[model samples]
Target: MNERFNKLRQYNTSGLGCWVSLIIFALIVGKIGLGGVVSGFLILIALFFLVPVIGFWGFQWWLKQKITQAQCPVCEYEFTGLKNTEFNCPSCGESLRVEGDRFTRMTPPGTIDVDAVEVSVQRIEEEN
Candidate 1:
């Protein structure tokens, strides 16, 4: 039941805590000189906006690194795609499926037709 609360307990800092801390710090520094207040304000803005923006782009770069490159099995045309993706080969127009670092022909969807003999069911009276 405690799992509901302690789900790894991630730091959910959305920069507001820094803003509050800087406001208090800035007010103290503001007593010293106007320059200190201005510098604190600049630092607060940089931390609030620039930090998250840089982190977002950095995460995107990390994820893009995982999207591997593969080649079309039929035409040998190389391309990049996410794992287990199926798409048409851009160079040859052949349907291709990707898995891990390699590519293969996409198997056609739907069940195969099977020829079978039809059987008739008859009801018989059971003797006691």
Candidate 2:
């Protein structure tokens, strides 16, 4: 989970870097009077925003690929969602906790046991 989060973070950082550089490049071109060319200006505008948007969407898809479904230890209910520190069981209403890649049932009163059962990761089929 941490690895996936780090990968997404790196993607976001790179996207931001690209956006900044493109903005700078656009500013330089505008200062040099290339902005007078409508086509060049339009292309620059598109690149200044479009590249980061595409990158963000691609990273989102990658992040979704890394997520796997986890079963509720208390109710055996399966759930497909992002990794979170805590979540409620859909079937039993039990609070569930996540540590690293492991999902376990949280004890009542908000306490986590040392011997919590480990939830298995269910494989997700990729769509074309």
Candidate 3:
């Protein structure tokens, strides 16, 4: 019946808490009267706490823009990686390059296959 919490979400929108804090602050000031010790202290708190909260929110937004989820084309493995970079898929060990939202299969450099294993007599004795 309540429209306030109809949406199923883990958290509210960004900066909602700060806005609520400011509103509660105004309510407290209204009740206690203006130009008093309590109002001055509340204003000081809003300056120190609210400003940094807003700044950190902006930093978080910037970080989201620079990093994103990348899916491996060969194995369809999803992972978090920086935008426009190459990394091996943890699931399949396949080299993949991420460009924007696109995942491209890339060939790893300087990888050589061994035809045989050569072991010395001392090495074989140590293994046994």
Candidate order by lDDT, decreasing, is 1, 3, 2
User: Model 2 clash pairs?
Assistant: none
Q: What are the per-residue Cα lDDT tens digits for candidate 2 across 1-128?
A: 67888876754355788899889879877777664667677989999999999999999998976565878777678886467657787788887786556567766676655566899999999999
Predictions in order: lDDT: 0.79, 0.76, 0.78
TM-score for candidate 1:
0.44
What lDDT would candidate 1 get against the real structure? 0.79
TM-score of each: 0.44, 0.43, 0.45
Model 3 spans with C-alpha error above 4 angstroms = 1-44, 108-128
Clashing pairs in 3: none
Best by lDDT: 1
- Model 1, range 13-56, lDDT digits (tens) per residue? 79989999989887787677878778889999989999999999
| Tens-digit per-residue lDDT, 58-88, candidate 3 | 9999889878786777668788877778778
